[model samples]
Target: MSAAPEQAVAGRLSFLDRYLAVWILAAMALGLGLGRVVPGLGDALAEVTVTGVSLPIALGLLVMMYPVLAKVRYDRLDTVTRDRRLLLPSLLLNWIVGPALMFALAWLFLPDLPEYRTGLIIVGLARCIAMVIIWNDLACGDREAAAVLVALNSVFQVVAFSALGWFYLSVLPGWLGLEQSGEMGSHLLEQSRELGGVSVWEIARSVLIFLGIPLTAGYLTRRIGEKAKGRAWYESELIPRIGPFALYGLLFTIVILFALQGDAITSQPLDVARIALPLLVYFALMWAGSMALGRSVGLNYSRATTLAFTAAGNNFELAIAVAIATFGATSGQALAGVVGPLIEVPVLIGLVYVALYARRYFTTPAPLTEEDPAHA
Candidate 1:
């Protein structure tokens, strides 16, 4: 028999759950092409004025994040205590191993390329927000576990990003090359000019304006929907309606970003290729490292995949916003951040399949319980 409407919707998303990375990649390519052909498209869209306020590409990011954040079952947080196995691996991979290795690779491969180097760090520092949950769901991961990790990671990024940026830009350059070290301060100063004299406070305001407002609106909407009807109605009716809009908004924003940067990308086609190498290496290393840690800690296959994919993916939206604020939309740092989704999507999609098939090898039989008496 055919499934119910909700079941049909769920089943449709099942394909998306498995192949989301593909969609992201397709979006990236389409955006890149549109960007090259029609410069100023992104900027024009970004300037979409409503009541004297211009909506930037960042707004699209905020909109896209709504569905994911709204679905976060915050109440379930208490029910979901941390699994040290999952937590430690994720922490080590994201903060310690992932960033360190990415910095080293970027330095080695992109010597003297300051803007690209900064972009590499941006990718490495930001943890995945959207796709990680999709990955976890696809892998049959513990939903509560994924939600808790996302919340914790989001908190950590706020604290760590600035410090990590300073370390990578200020400290690491000296170790990488004396010439690069000497130019580090100057490069940062020049990059800062790309902000067109925008203050950090102004950037923070934009973040609040974009991310905060939408998030608040989404939460309020969800709440009202829930109170008026119940969790079932909210999930069944409201989420489905809102969810697709978020994706469409995301794609539209990406198109705009590409349109704005199309000329730059066309002029420097090789730059994208150069940036992709280190990121490719970084993704693979983090993925492998997460899996190993998960095994060492004795996590189940589903939980292990969750930890692995979470560690591997980059929160490009946050990176792009920070890049634009710090280095302007035209800066190489911003371009590098833009390059992240291009490479990340396809690679992650492949990993999803690998995780699905590899589960057989990783899965362990349930431990026998004394009360069951099956062994006895």
Candidate 2:
């Protein structure tokens, strides 16, 4: 009855999504101004924390994450497993090719700045779980496949991110004959500076707090809403209203981050540019390559677009959280993670236009109904 989630997504870009760049910029400006003018405020906010994780950011993540996860039709994820042609290739690109590419690029580009390089490596390992859906929908991609990819990525990242990160941050650089940072030792889980030594539980606790809570909440919300209200009403009425709040939470989070760390950002303006260069290369390379991979594999435009977007985007929230946790919130490493969202919105929007233009070259797969001779 309700247009499938894919069709429903294409109606229009909501105002927040359309002009996210402006708001992000505004938030950064506000943060910078606050950091310079009212430093005390940010310092006070910084003091407010739970188990060394910043209180404001933790709340912000939950608020920003819930809506996107809620929109996902987890029940449809089984469809992805059925299409191994698309699924297997996507996994390879997302986990293997994607991480390897970014790691190589970061070292090649930023050899001198170990902290910044570490940040980029973290970004690469994080992969895309949340925002790829937005990019997929905007590109007129196969929403069902994108949703499954997101869910899979979520689970995969939680499991594999730390191990891969440890290898890259500690082991890979040594193998490559690069000098590793002393601060980034074999400490995979310990995060807090003042708490003496954070245990393994802290790592799981942070992941559970940031990801598990919102995911469970989102799934429950969707299941309950659909059961209580009919599909049409739930889709049209509920999603539209709840959707924009995520952006609001993100904007607020940016303000808090920049407000606290604006000095680091302003002192090293070139750091943003430096961090951005590899990301720019990574996003462009992945997007183009995934699209090509999809076409070579005989996927129609919708499925191809989904693969492209899911491959290209990174989970900036998780990257940011990890960066803040591993390195301090105001560290140069964390700054690069902050720079991610700032760059993602504009770049992905441009790529959306690129995808639309690219769509004409690819064929749409026939609908299931149309595929049958009887229907024809």
RMSD of each: 7.2, 6.6
Across 1-376, the per-residue lDDT of candidate 1 in tens digits comes to 1225324434445344335556666677777787667656756755675432346565666666676557555566575565676777677788888888888888788876878887787678777765565555444455566766765676666666667766666666656553344566576745543533334454344445544565567668778778899898887777766665555555665565565566666678799899989989988888877877787788877677778888898877667777876777788888898788777766776776676556656656222222111110
lDDT for 237 (candidate 2): 85
Residue 269 C-alpha lDDT in model 2: 73
TM-score of 1: 0.75
Best by TM-score: 2
Model 1 lDDT on a 0 to 1 scale: 0.66
lDDT of 1 at 77: 59
Q: How many residue pairs collide in each prediction?
A: 3, 0
CA lDDT of every candidate: 0.66, 0.72
lDDT of 2 by residue, 211-251 (tens): 67877898898899999997678678887778777778767
For each candidate, give its TM-score against the true structure.
0.75, 0.77
